[model samples]
Target: MARITIIETGHVPRKYRERHGSFPDMFARMVRAADPQSTFDIVSIPDGDALPDPRQVQAILITGAAAGVYDGLDWIAPLEEFVRTAHANRTPMVGVCFGHQLIAQALGGTVRKSDKGWGIGRHVYQVTPNNGVVAGEQLAVACSHQDQVIEAPGDARTILSSDFTPHAGLLYANGTTLSVQPHPEFDADFAHVCCELREGSAPDAVVATAKASLAEPLDSAKLGAAITRFLTRR
Candidate 1:
């Protein structure tokens, strides 16, 4: 069993709080499915309190957030430093959405507010011509973000992409670091909540797709595959 630490990027404000399962909930579910005996811990590191010692955590999964990676938030920089250091140390890492952007930015990539507006709703992402991170023909995922990575970092390879976002996913160092633009952690009710969170109008088919996912959490299986790939990498 490996110990994994998740750095939470969602700020729980008064507007969204209660018994409602939070973003960490989805991330947690994924990790558990991936590695049943894995140890997981949730910490609100918005302040970027020196990242956990890598020796203690075999892999780190950074969750998605409402804010962009280039928002100039105080915590983003330190977190970026931690990301780079972890990568250098061979600690398996998986970043989601903003996490994906930060990994690119930390490694000399570019992140900017997209003029095309928010990529909200259920969109399709195409796997790279040949890559293992996405490991599928195509994936229909939930997307919600205003910023996009225009270019991949010096050491990263674009694995998955879509017209709306060119660098939808990046696979680094054969498999050590993987970042995804979409939110695979979202289920049906959570998807609907997120849709409402983004004020997105849920149509019939979209709702149905989302509902099906909620009933059967394949996101965890996908995440489990990622964990196995990352930890067992050569």
Candidate 2:
């Protein structure tokens, strides 16, 4: 079985963690979908220095974080360096929300807090026609983020989008790397909890109504197959 080293850079802060749970639930599901047999050692480097080297790993999955990529954090520069080197060396890399932003920032692109409302719940992401990453497939994915990639990291191509999120997903021209802004790992219950903690209401009538239209459960199997396709190459 192949091993995946997941570097989790996102958390809701300790004061908030008791209410939110200690993990990003959605990424776990996607990893499950990727390969149930695949085991993972999660390295949560909130401080960033504790971050591990990906060179020894089979794959690197950067989990979503609540932090903005542009914040003057101590670890941003080093992590950005790690990503560029990983890509350059042909190590397969996958970025989620904050992870997506970091990758973009490192590769001559940018990330900014969207003036738009924080997208929560399952959002439908439209796959561009014949995108090799999406393979011409669309997914009703889950998301909870306020910042996004405004442009592709240098030498990257857009593969999926929605009217709300332009950089919903991207693939490096190297074809070995890809990322999804909307989470494939979110189950309804966990996603609802995230909404509850972040927005103070998940089952709220208005919120539920919004999520009703957006939150379609994507099969874990489908996402796993897609991840497998992504990692098998670079």
Candidate 3:
């Protein structure tokens, strides 16, 4: 069995929690779908759970957050340090959305609220050739973020790309770290709700487009399986 520790940096709103579940719950479900024997441990930072030593965990997964990587929250610095420590220890790590940006920023990349506006709903990314982490040539996944990793870390390679999010997925030189700007754990219903939540914050047209995109199929299962494989690979 593969033991994965999930660092929960954010929460699903109270209104949606009952139906959509928390970020860790979503991830656990996704991972279990791919590897039924996989087990999980959730460490919620917002709940004041202290970060764990990276070396002690078999693998680490950082979940998406509503907070930006550069938000300067008290927990941000420590979380970044944790990511750095985990990377240095060569712990197999996977990050999604905010987690992706956080990992990049901690490793000397640039993250900022993009002028390109919010990338909500479903977006397709082209997988770079021979990127061993994710199979196939393209991936369509749910996304909800304004912040982006504009500049990737020096030791990172762009494995997934789209016109909107050029640095959609990054694979670190260390070979044990991987991150993606989209949410593979998000099901279509949850993704639609995420779009609804952006009704006022995002442009009406963008929100509508995002909501419409959800009517189509998403490649979430494919990516989820890939993540599970990455985390459990020997």
Candidate 4:
């Protein structure tokens, strides 16, 4: 069984927490569906939990966060440093959404709130052939973020792309590090609720479209399996 450490940087809303659980919990469920024997250890940065040594971890997954990569939070810098150290050690690592942007910024990439606006709900991405992670032409998954990786790292390859999110998924040259801007851990129910939460913050039309997009089937399970395979592969 592979022991994966999940770095939790955000929290679910109080009302939704009871039904959807925490981000790490969702990820555990998603990963276990693909690898039944996989075990997990969660380190919540927002809860004041210290980061574990990357060299000691079998694999590391950074969860999505409400905070932006350029927010200048006290913990943000340390976490970026952690990502750098972990990548240097060639530790198998995957990052989602905010985690994706964090990893990109930590490397040589640029991240910022895009003028293209928010990308919520179910978004489809064109998968690059022979990516070695996902095996498909297109991948549709949940997304909820305004910030994006404006510029990819020098050594990163665009494994997943869409017109809205050009750098949706990045596979580093290290071969052990990967990051995606979508959330395969989020179920339709949770995704819908996320759209509802954005009603006031996001434009009415965008929220409506996002909520409606959830009516279509999502390929979250497929992506989860791919992520599990990536992390557990020898």
Q: Could you estimate the TM-score for every candidate?
A: 0.83, 0.85, 0.99, 0.99
The lDDT values for all models are 0.73, 0.72, 0.95, 0.95
Pairs that collide in candidate 4 are none
TM-score of candidate 2 versus the correct structure, residues matched by position: 0.85
User: What's the lDDT of the predicted structure labeled candidate 3?
Assistant: 0.95
**Candidate 2 lDDT:** 0.72
What are the per-model C-alpha RMSD values against the true structure? Answer: 3.8, 3.3, 0.6, 0.6
Candidate 3: clashing pairs of residues = none
TM-score, candidate 4, is: 0.99
**Per-residue alpha-carbon lDDT of candidate 4 for residues 66-168, written as tens digits (9 for 90 to 100):** 9999999999999999999999999999999999999999998999999989899999999999998999899999999999999999999999999999999
- Which stretches of model 4 miss by more than 4 angstroms? none
Model 2: weakest 10-residue lDDT segment is 197-206
Compose the digit string of candidate 3's lDDT tens values, residues 90-134. 999999999999999999999999999999999999999898888
Using lDDT as the measure, the top candidate is 4
| lDDT of model 3, residue 153 | 97
Q: Candidate 3 — worst ten consecutive residues by lDDT sum?
A: 129-138
Collision count for each candidate, in order: 1, 4, 0, 0
Task: Report the poorest 10 consecutive residues by lDDT, candidate 1.
Answer: 211-220
